[model samples]
Target: MKVGIIGIGHMGQAIIDGLLNTMKSEELILSNHRINDAMTTYQEEHQIEVVTDNQSVINANPDFVIFTTPAPVTLAVMQEFKTLSAQTVILSAAAGISLAEINAILPEQPVALLMPNTPVAVNHGTLGVALNEYITDSEPIESFLQQLGDVFITSEREFGIFGTVTGCGPAFVDVFMAALGDAAVKNGLNRELAYQAAASMVKGSASLMQETNIAPDVLKDQVTTPGGSTIRGVVALEQHAFRAAVIDAVEASNG
Candidate 1:
């Protein structure tokens, strides 16, 4: 199936990277408001068609037309494509745009909302998807989404929290790792090695938690001896209100 993409921002690029493995280069068409050096390089490297105008993307007869424009620009882009056939499915990845808003403008068209993180570049992303009434069978879309990573079907209301946990969680984890890496450097470890080790530890710990189905607290307790350094570090985090800070971060993202 032909798929057209409008906008090539970070999320858009990540999605393109994931789709390239599942779809043929000739089946993909991309467009941006203005082509930059990066866009030119991406087009050359991927060998995908990059059209000059939005209309040309739709003219390509794509089954799926994905809009990865900024939230503020999403509605305008949809309005511009108002004449598109109802047979085409529209997918939006803008952060704050909702299905109701999309349907209000293009009432006959099927629309899908997706919030995917940057890790889609590595094909290990988490995507939160919400479909409108027009979409009857999700298997086709779900199959494509699975290629990116895990898929969580959720309501628009829950998408905010999903965005917080999966979309923004990576940055939070990076911040935590940077802190640990800083401490490691202070203790005489090479800065690059410290960062690499910290990332590996976090990745392995998360994998372990998922594979073993162990509660985080249980795992933490198992690793912490009565008077051990692990317990001391845990206590220090508690004293500094680390848990509360993370909760606040999620809440802030939701708002």
Candidate 2:
């Protein structure tokens, strides 16, 4: 299937990385403001078609066109794209640009507002998705999304909260993991091993909760024994207002 990608920034490249896993290089049509040496080499090495104009990508008649550009850029390009109709699905990763805003620009076309994070490069991201009313057949697009990450299907109204948590949560987890590594270093563990250990533990713990269908509190209880070291650490975290701080962080991000 032919896929058109507008913008070749970090997020755009990440999304392309995920798409490349499921699609051949030739299947993608990329358009950017200016082509540099890096992009020249990228397209040559990957054998992907690269265009300097948005209209050129549009002319390819792709099944879907994903916009990873800034909101203003996406809108500017959409305004200039007179021929984009309902045949191509519009999936945009421009944050805070609502579906209504997009539909206002192109009233009769199908559009989906997508909030994605950096991990999508590795196909392990969590994406916030909201499809417009024009999208009647969701299965194809949703299945297409599964190739990238966990798809959180919700109303566009809920995207703000979902974007804050999933989009910003990765950075929060990285901070927590770094703190854990520092503590481990003080206990005589090597820095590299400490980071790996912390990451592995976090991954395993998350998988346990998911696979067992158990609540976080119940899972924590299973790991904590009476007067155990785990409980001591947990209690220390609680005393430091870790939970409250997390809630505050989410609130701050959403705001």
Q: Who wins the lDDT comparison?
A: 1
Q: Give me the overall lDDT of model 2.
A: 0.87
Which segments of candidate 1 are over 4 A away from where they belong? none
Model 1 TM-score (2 dp):
0.93
Runs with alpha carbons beyond 4 Å of true place in candidate 2 = 37-49
Task: Point out the worst 10-residue segment of candidate 1 by lDDT.
Answer: 49-58
Report, for every candidate in turn, its global Cα lDDT versus the true structure. Answer: 0.88, 0.87
The per-prediction tally of clashing pairs is: 0, 0
lDDT of 1 by residue, 1-255 (tens): 888888898889999998897778888888889888988998899887677698887787888898899999889888888888788888899988889999999996889998899888778899988999999988888887787888888887787788789999999999999999999999999999999999999989988998999999999999999999999999999999999999999988877
Colliding residue pairs in candidate 2: none
Query: Candidate 2, after superposition: displacement of residue 143 in Å?
Result: 0.7
Quantify how close model 1 is to the true structure by its C-alpha RMSD in Å: 1.7
Over 1-255, each residue of candidate 2 has an lDDT whose tens digit, in order, gives 888888988888888888888888888889888899998887777677678888777778888899998877688777866687568899989877888888888987999988889889889888888999999988888888888988888898898899999889999999999999999999999999999999999889988987899999999999899999999999999999999999999999998
